[model samples]
Target chain A: MSARELPLLFIRHAVAEDSHVLGDEARALTPEGRAAFRHHARKLARLTPLRGIITSPLVRAVQTAELLAEAFGVSGVEVHPALLPQRGAHKRIVDLGRERGAGWALVGHNPSLERAAIRALEHELPDKLRKGAALALHPLKNGGFTLAWWATPGKPVKRPGDLR
Target chain B: MSARELPLLFIRHAVAEDSHVLGDEARALTPEGRAAFRHHARKLARLTPLRGIITSPLVRAVQTAELLAEAFGVSGVEVHPALLPQRGAHKRIVDLGRERGAGWALVGHNPSLERAAIRALEHELPDKLRKGAALALHPLKNGGFTLAWWATPGKPVKRPGDLR
Candidate 1:
């Protein structure tokens, strides 16, 4: 594809606060989670210049969008509850995707991510929520999203006797 | 890149407690921060399945790496001062990156990340480092590192205010 027709980034939120420690609406990213978040924030600047940032208003999503916006030198983001994946969430994003032309990221929680990643983009997925994972979705000129790239947070170097 | 060669993930540390609010070393990720971490931790699991974790002994790095270990299903990360950035940090990671041949993730700070990301992997940077950012490096048989992906934590993602 030409640089003119790039892809949209569908990023899963990075790490978040413990579910038990905080309510779904209030949970945030842990300290290490912050590192995990920054790791990617810096990394993204290296790949392609991002467009606009969007995410669920849920604490985790807001946090993710906020940090990303700050990094690429932006003011704020447009929050879309439709990205949340709750009941009736799909209709919101689906309709939005159809109407919107191009260049945007959709940030949200899982089950929705799992559904969108596999069903919409066709990327192989393991489970519902793969925190901090991102799928590049290109809404084709003809309609429908395309899978460009996928990334999960960290990977460990395995040594001898490493428990597989 | 081929299926045979595995890549590694190295993340930048999360934001510490507001510098004015807590001791620099004793700081931790705020409530909002934890949510971001969890979001990404889940994302890491779907990829290569982390084998081991590594980080500095500082409360922040340990805290960040720990969350990821749990999410990735690893017990905990082993620490090495050599990984710490305060004292000749870049040289240490350069040596460490040279020694590494497996899929691994190291949580540390930056500008050390620039050393780790640029020296270990071949990439063209697009922006600056904010609080939480990430970079992915996949080494080639020819000994060059490939910048697989990069991300920032916040809004106005790219230059034009879209998800390019």
Candidate 2:
């Protein structure tokens, strides 16, 4: 990690079944989604070791967090209701990170997480959050976040120069 | 493609030899870069057929563009001097796309391409352009561009519903 940079990993859950069948918040990862997310977890483990993971209490997010914790040998993921599909929850995650003085992986839903990205990094994304996609943000000395790199599930881990 | 969207695929060049040995614009892709780019080209071929590819005159960009053209069976890539490391070049690529009324793949360098992404999509990515990362931008009906998707050289091609 660079001296002036603080890294934050924001991940969206992998694919889930139709929301109509199960309630929106209760949906779980599909078999393929699970398999792909495991790949993401492995890729992530190769990249950086997470000091902490804060995730939504929602089923899918928790599931994603669990896989990450298992992959990185973290104690466990901490569930935060603030990570639920709501506005400004990103702030809470950031607050948690600042309090811990360490990096964190935040797993949550779309639009809101994107919003949190915009608020934290002050940039817009081209589309909605893709299932199993992650954005790595690094804090700037100017008090804003800069996009460090991004990855998608089912993708292989990249080499040093492969990431910006 | 959506009626309201004009797709733009922005690609960075593959790995290159250090500038110390060759002139910056003349540096060629490394063997590893060529192999990785072939994979990316195949991935792009599977995604969508490009109406046109406009690339920087820089050796690396041209090399990357040639690989894309070969993979997609396009006749050839057009050289765009505007794509050379400079300010506001992304706009030129967008202008060309608007003029053609079709999707175009722009091959160029970083910071410049990343700036173009910011100018065209109004989004901030986490880091500098990776050696062969591509961002898909779709122009919205309301004006401005949205990132439809993104891919890296080593990452796998995603299936529908794989991204939530």
Candidate 3:
């Protein structure tokens, strides 16, 4: 948000069922899942200065990504399949991230989401990310990004809210 | 959810603001607004089986309306301004409780929402309503509606893990 700081934020998809049974496309958030996003969004927005959001195309991921995008006032969400857990998906995502550049956010599936976050952090995965969790990182000039602190959804350890 | 309980659910639009400066067509959800809707959707879905959804044609209302419809497998969200909040100088609303003639889920704006909810109860008012609050009315054998419950959106709630 400030010229002094480079922008970056990491966010996970909302709760989703395991694959093979539902097929990602058929999946939709359960009522509780949607609400959880809302709850965390308020907290995320309060803690960070986010520019844009990139997310997976699947419904739950797309919807979850949009929650943070909306909270940050981003114009619209762009789809990136690489953020998916599927193998061989990151190529497109990396390309998309480069084109979009720094100061943006990534909203996507699990492992991929953590991977992208680490890639931004120069290849260091934060502790495991839970659904609806948001990790904010700062891309440093010396190469590799700085850990801006990975915060759980709904409320951060550093920032207090209704949850606390 | 049970055959004996026959429930009706109403979902409120998330954070939205009407600007005197802009025309109605241009108004849309604030970033926080969209988050609010997406946030609560999960919980609302859990409250009932989420059979159907109906909405007003207004853009902001409709956008917020679609999220709920999509989350619940509402199958379709019918747009009808008959449920809309009157524009600029007009402030009257139709009580669809008697007209709609049965239990249904509706998504729309204030006063109108309250009027619709109360019509099933007592059919009068200057009433009090808040953002993202919902109520249900049961249709009696005598063709009157009785108030079931009123629910207010909780700021932070959970997202759906999967549609069960």
By TM-score, the best candidate is 3
- By DockQ, the candidates rank as 3, 1, 2
10 residues in a row with least lDDT, candidate 2 chain B: B155-164
Lowest summed lDDT across 10 adjacent residues in model 1 chain B is found at B155-164
Which is the leading candidate under lDDT? 2
Index of the highest-DockQ prediction: 3
TM-score versus the correct structure, for each prediction: 0.44, 0.45, 0.49
Error of 3 at B128 (Å): 36
Over A1-164, each residue of candidate 1 has an lDDT whose tens digit, in order, gives: 45336556667888875662224654556657666766777666555566667667555665576556645544335555568658756556655555543556677877665665565654554433467766556677666766555556664312223312
Q: Could you tell which candidate, 1 or 2, scores higher by lDDT? A: 2
Which TM-score does chain B of candidate 1 obtain?
A: 0.79
Q: Which ten residues in a row have the lowest lDDT in candidate 1 chain A?
A: A155-164
- Give TM-score values for chain A, per-prediction: 0.79, 0.82, 0.78
- On residues B1-164, what C-alpha lDDT tens digit does candidate 1 reach at each position? 33336556677766656652224543456546655765666665555565566666444565566566656766435565556667568667756655664567777887776665666654435555555565556666776666655555543223212323
> lDDT scores for all predictions?
0.60, 0.67, 0.57
Where in model 1 is the C-alpha error above 4 Å?
Answer: A1-4, A20-22, A122-129, A155-164, B1-164
lDDT of 2 by residue, B1-164 (tens): 55335467888988876762324754656657767787788987887777767777555665577567657766435555557787777777666545543377888887778777777766576445688888777766555676677778887543324444
Question: What is the fnat value (0 to 1) for candidate 1?
Answer: 0.00
lDDT tens readout by residue for model 3, A1-164: 47337446667777754542325543545557766776778777776665676665455665576556556666645454456567755455555555555667777666766666656556655357888887655555554556666677554543223223
Preferred candidate (TM-score higher): 1 or 3 = 3
